[model samples]
Target: MSEKQETPEQRRERLRQEEGRGNPAGDMNDAANRASNGSLVDLTGSLGWKGTGILALFMVLAFIIYAVFFR
Candidate 1:
């Protein structure tokens, strides 16, 4: 008996069609959630006490410099 075999592209298309039957939006959301598992800004890790202090110090110093020089 002569049977026709699916080509690689046809197999791939069939698999893709099968995958499309699932929740694509849910899959995308799952991927996004995995990608952003933690905080977006990460202030706790990237800007700890020292970084916060430095930022506060810069703001205060800038205000003082502007008041003394320009105001």
Candidate 2:
């Protein structure tokens, strides 16, 4: 009797099944849950509008200086 060979799709399915058996929760956890309790901090609130504005102004000034003088 001749043995049946698996197709590419069948081989891929087998590999997926084996991976699922090895790590059942592999898909459950991801980069979205890297932060504990799913709480991504609000930098805007912590930094405040004034602080953020100052930072933005400084960044703009630096960019302008770089473009004007360096380039």
Candidate 3:
């Protein structure tokens, strides 16, 4: 039985072909050209008016506490 081992160049070409087949048109690179694949932080959809008001109140309270105690 005769078995042929792949050369380094042949192996590299094979891997390159596999990568091309895995992601045609090199679109995967384009798609991954970002820090993350998800959207930025946006609470507008999840936070209702009441939630927004509460968040604002918390911020004001935090600022007041920091100023009154730290100053």
Candidate 4:
């Protein structure tokens, strides 16, 4: 039987090396740049009109159904 042996420091070093090679910070920076450059649209203001209309429609329909069936 062969046993794999790895010390805690060796495991930590391996993880650190892997993370450095993966360059997650660079990916985050790219994402931030894209977001700041308007590649992503700001939806908070538009949602007030569209989402509110949909929600109000849903509430009206729910009230109509409840009145017809439950009361």
Q: Which structure among the candidates has the greatest TM-score? A: 3
Kindly list the per-residue Cα lDDT of model 4 for residues 21-43, writing each as its tens digit: 78988757766786878531233
The C-alpha TM-scores of every prediction are 0.38, 0.40, 0.42, 0.35
- The lDDT of each candidate is 0.66, 0.61, 0.62, 0.64
Question: What lDDT score is found at residue 46 in candidate 1?
Answer: 59
- Which digits, one per residue and each the tens of the lDDT, describe model 1 over residues 7-68? 54456556655675697887577557747795423443457678878878998999999999
lDDT of 3: 0.62
Q: lDDT ranking from best to worst?
A: 1, 4, 3, 2
Candidate 4: segments with Cα more than 4 A from true spot: 1-46
TM-score-wise, the better of 3 and 4 is 3
Model 1 — TM-score against the truth? Answer: 0.38
The candidate that achieves the highest lDDT relative to the unseen native structure:
1
Work out candidate 2's RMSD over C-alphas: 16.4
Q: List candidate 3 stretches off by more than 4 Å.
A: 1-41
Error of 4 at 19 (Å): 46
Residues forming the 10-long window of minimal summed lDDT in candidate 1: 38-47
